[model samples]
Target: MFQRSISYTALLVGLFDASAAVADLTADRVWAQTIDMIEEAGGSITALATRDGDNLNISNVRFTFDIPDTDETVIVSMDGWSLLEKGGKVHVEQPDYQEIVVKVAGQDDVTARLGYSVRGDMGVYSEVEDTLIQTWDIARAEVKLIELIAPDYDPAEATVEFVLSMNDAISNMMYMGNGHQQSVQSLGEMAFDMTIVTPAEDIDLSASARMRGLMNEGFQTVNFKGTPDEILAELTAGGGLRANSALDGMEFKMEGNVEGEVFNVSFAADKASSNVNIDNGNASVSADINDIAFNAFVPAEIPLPLSGGIEKIAYDIDIPLAAAPEVQQVHIGMEYLGLGISDTIWAMFDPTGQLDRAPIDLIVDLSAGVRLDRDLIDPNIEELMEQDPTQFGSIESLGLNELLVSALGAVAIGSGDFTFDMNDLQTFDGIPRPEGEASIVVSGLNSVFDQLIEAGLLQPDQLMPIRMGLGMGFVATGEDELTSEVEVRSNGGVYVNGQRMR
Candidate 1:
């Protein structure tokens, strides 16, 4: 019995070893697929990808891309690449590059000593489908753009450092028989810092963008209906682009500065974001900045600290991508939510200290629903754009939802819902004529003028002329309220505030 048990144990050990070997061999097949993908992406890769024990090592890897119909070519070479499988997960890493070269036909080759390193984790098998999934975290990546064979870089010369990183990034790839579907999600940041120096000027710029709460809500389909090269050609010819993928939410920001001997200017923003629902052909984007600022330092000839900015600035845009005339709507709004000046700078212009120091508020909101001739989200967009840019996007009708502006303790709001006469474009001098009535309501106009005069910013003589103009164009609707009505008749006559203006 003891001898029989020993034999059985040996058999089990042999079976386990055979299974492990098969898993090791699978790496080579996967690497072949990766190479195919690179080739599909317009690059040629040459390397010996092999598995060593439980790890795969690709040695002396070289990748190259040539610009079509041009002598420009980009080449990237690396010494070592590695991928290891453990605990049902694959980990990937690559050594620093030996060199990177960009060659143009008639210009001196631009080259750099490239450095790259990556560490990522990927599941061996998919949990959702019979596909592959990868979750990667970029440890560190930097490209030092410098001249080739330059022993040392000059501090004053132009130099750029581009850095990218990710905290948690996940990607899913589903391989159909002839095509593939993919989705990517990440939360991280990217930064680009550059310095340029010359005999005439010196400039330094640093920009950083962060992305969080990001998710590609749907899988993007890459149809391989024909050969790889054929597909690539079609895409390059602007024949195959489509909107098959949708993103849930994303935010971005870019801030930098320019400095020189004569002037220095700094500008920055904190927020730019998008929320997309492409399935329903609905999307909204908002670019907002709180505490965004701009400041300039220049020659003393200006005699003032030239600095001013909006404390809050925002623009919101909404669109229906695939809807037609009756259902299509496009909305956009811009607002200087808060406007302000520094006390030191304000004091330069208002030496009497009579002006209000508090920041002012301004808001402008507008939206319009329009009828369209075709779907805006059609996949074959290149053909449409090439035929006639304006003719393809003809507008049939316009329904103004709201037009609002509030500032300096006063408000003005108006709306115009009208149909456009496309055939009579020449009547309105190239723009389609509108048949509608628009009305604007203004409040606190007198009070606003009084405040400006009290602050010494407006003289009484100037205020009187403005008031008289308002009296001619607007009617008093209520206490401290003014109403202005504008009408565009079907016969092309125009009226303003119950008076014939045209």
Candidate 2:
């Protein structure tokens, strides 16, 4: 973000010159032309707003492409009545699928406000057409910069580019038979680096997304290093069975021997429909996060001759993540059909490499069924069904809310074998998410407790709430030596307790 004040006060000295009439501008023409200009400059725009006097007021302008693209455009808010250049300030109306206003502080020094929206398709499509036709949208979303950085001496001009590091929270739904299918097998995030053009620009910027229909998971290559024991201890810490859930919105910060290279986010979708690979020095990790679909029928409202309102729905995603180190292949799969949707995902890496910046070499060999929200394209689908389930009498309604509750209920424990290619692992925080594949042997109910103790993450006396809250308990008599083995490999050597686990 470039922060400063531009006092067009000197316009009278020159700018306000012979061009007395700055191309008679209107909001519409200004918007259209803004797109033209940004595209001309290798960028695109998303929202538009105006800084009234000393304040910035945004409009209700939300735009998305037919399919996702590297949309980099600038937003110019021309008065509906005049072309008077509006003060520059960027605001985000939707960051985390939720509604919140992003405040932009700009004085007379600002030129034009810019906005960006990026989306790209990278699914395991049978053909290019399949991937192209798919449609995806964000439901509930949120994001925060929390912190940022600027170059030295405060440059002359700067523009910070913020990208929504892809699949941070994407849940996909696939078409199966007459109904839709859904899945939970997921992927990770990649942060983007912000570009600074000058010192006269504002430094505040934002990015966010909310995936509602599918599990946005793909493979990628990454390079990173961290203390072995510290990481392993954190890994086996007491976050409990719902580690993913607990780490849900947490982002990692890593320091490396490398410079700005780890700062930019690069997410690969199909990458030509191939597999992903990453090699680490001591522990590099490389694997493919394929979308596997489970077969199921999603509820859909059959439009009637004189029907009105929305429909009701319920679905599921069953996945088995397993693999071997030598091959380091993560076999992720699901069964989905017909109503299968056309979807998308986009990524923009961060300027500072403190966050996600892993090289991606993903393969879209995944075959899974997605359970879609009938309301995606049609809004009335859910309304009609909820107002009156009878409207869906002819449609197969599997009492949705019940199904999920029961399915979630059936999971006695969130225990699973976790494998990380020591070679590919970039960093180790409290611990790493259970990745790769291994035979999971759930024994002592002490999993949540033992994990924390083994990795020396938490004390048994610490709030066990994180564990018991998830409806889990120790299956062992006491904290006896619990054992589980993980067979994995990586270009970089593996580390456990700061020691090698392979």
Candidate 3:
């Protein structure tokens, strides 16, 4: 199900890419520029022609690209394509099919086909904003490939299909000032169903993605006062480009049969979203997979009686675009909530049922706050990609916040706030000099060990080293609980529980 949803995203991106490549052309002039635009994007048409009246026909339109240093060429083709100017709207459809073929050297070609169509409002321009807005509606975007043949794989018994329906999803695009700036936004819902048939199994998947709110303001409006490069320069100077996309109430599911056995999977999230904003010579990104319930089922023989899932998973990060000489702070956070397995699985691990299995859960709450010079990460991305790393950056301060975990009848929590000096590396033997301390507290530690001993998983003699290590590294803070205070001095000396280890 997730795979299908990802594919849907890719398809939408492809549609946008194709539309943006030719957005500057007016509806009245699209007929003459259609072929030219395709070629400009490195695609070729086997043949092109215009029908009498108000329609255009294109035959065997294809785009071919050769893999670098490889004997493979990927060809994407459309058959019996037509574009019509009707009632002030441009209607484009390829009723026959769209095909993709990969021809590999010394191998048979692989191919797939889909039924596709598109419709858009033409010459939608707004004088108030001095922007040319084009709106496209995808009423039918279906691909039902019965079988795709591959050289090393058998296609006689395999088939795949994709059925997508969008009733009111209107994609709005705006181009300003001779294509100097452009923006796009879309609303409405897309319904999709996909099927995959293989020799061993047949899988069916479905999903629905709907827009949650009105389109963003700046995403649909672009400034045209400057040239293309000039506009880009201005945006970069101010804060680089920014783009945001959001979806709410998204749902997906999948069911399949493997060798006559049945299985199912599904997930739902209150909201799934991503945002990228580049400003102040920095780029900040945040993504949320909120309130997610992932469940799976197998044949009764599998011995799983309940649905297991992740309640939520999310992450956020901030990064600098250019190097800064001063200490720049960056933040990162990741969290896992409500992670658990079935009680039946737990019972297997604790047959005696005296190990507090019900409380046997897993959670990771962690975040990083660090300060460092931008020069460490500052490098032209293009140039950095072409070589290997040499020198590394220095950290001024680090903060480990919200380090919490609860599992196996035990809970541990800790946080670290520390600072470092990069100039003095000898004290730490080539590492930065450090000055600060962090504390960790673990409850139910002794009780957990007692349970292990009671369960015969550990012997009394086995705890000798464990006890010695704990006595040396941690101090008893309470009954069945231990505490550790780790401190690093400016001289690079390290201590735990007030006892110097190094």
Write the residue-wise lDDT of candidate 1 on 1-502 in tens digits: 0111222123234223433322222455557767888898898989887778878898877788887877777777767567776655455655544344443332445555544434444334221223344444343345555454333445445555554454444444445333544444443443444444433234555444444433332333345657655554433343332222222223333333344335455665444433433334455666555556666665534655566666666777777654354646677777775677677686775676655455666555656655555555455667887887774455656655666666656777777767778788776789898888878898877777777777788999897788888888899999889998888888778899767877
Q: What tens digits encode model 3's per-residue C-alpha lDDT throughout 95-180?
A: 53455443343355676555554443322322213334344544434444444556655656665566665543445454444443
Please give the CA lDDT of all the candidate structures.
0.57, 0.28, 0.58
Where is model 3 more than 4 Å wrong at Cα?
A: 1-25, 28-59, 65-71, 80-106, 117-131, 152-167, 178-236, 249-270, 296-306, 357-393, 453-461
Name the candidate that leads on lDDT.
3
How many clashing residue pairs appear in each of the predictions shown?
2, 115, 0
**C-alpha positional error of residue 204 in candidate 3 after TM-score superposition, expressed in Å:** 11
Largest TM-score belongs to which candidate?
3
RMSD of 2: 27.0
Best-to-worst lDDT order: 3, 1, 2
Question: For model 2, how does the per-residue alpha-carbon lDDT over 381-449 read when each residue is reduced to its tens digit?
Answer: 577767864432221111111101111001121222333322333545423322433222233335445
Candidate 1: where are CA atoms >4 Å away?
1-25, 32-44, 48-56, 64-74, 84-91, 95-108, 117-130, 138-184, 188-272, 280-316, 320-327, 353-369, 377-394, 421-433, 444-472, 478-481
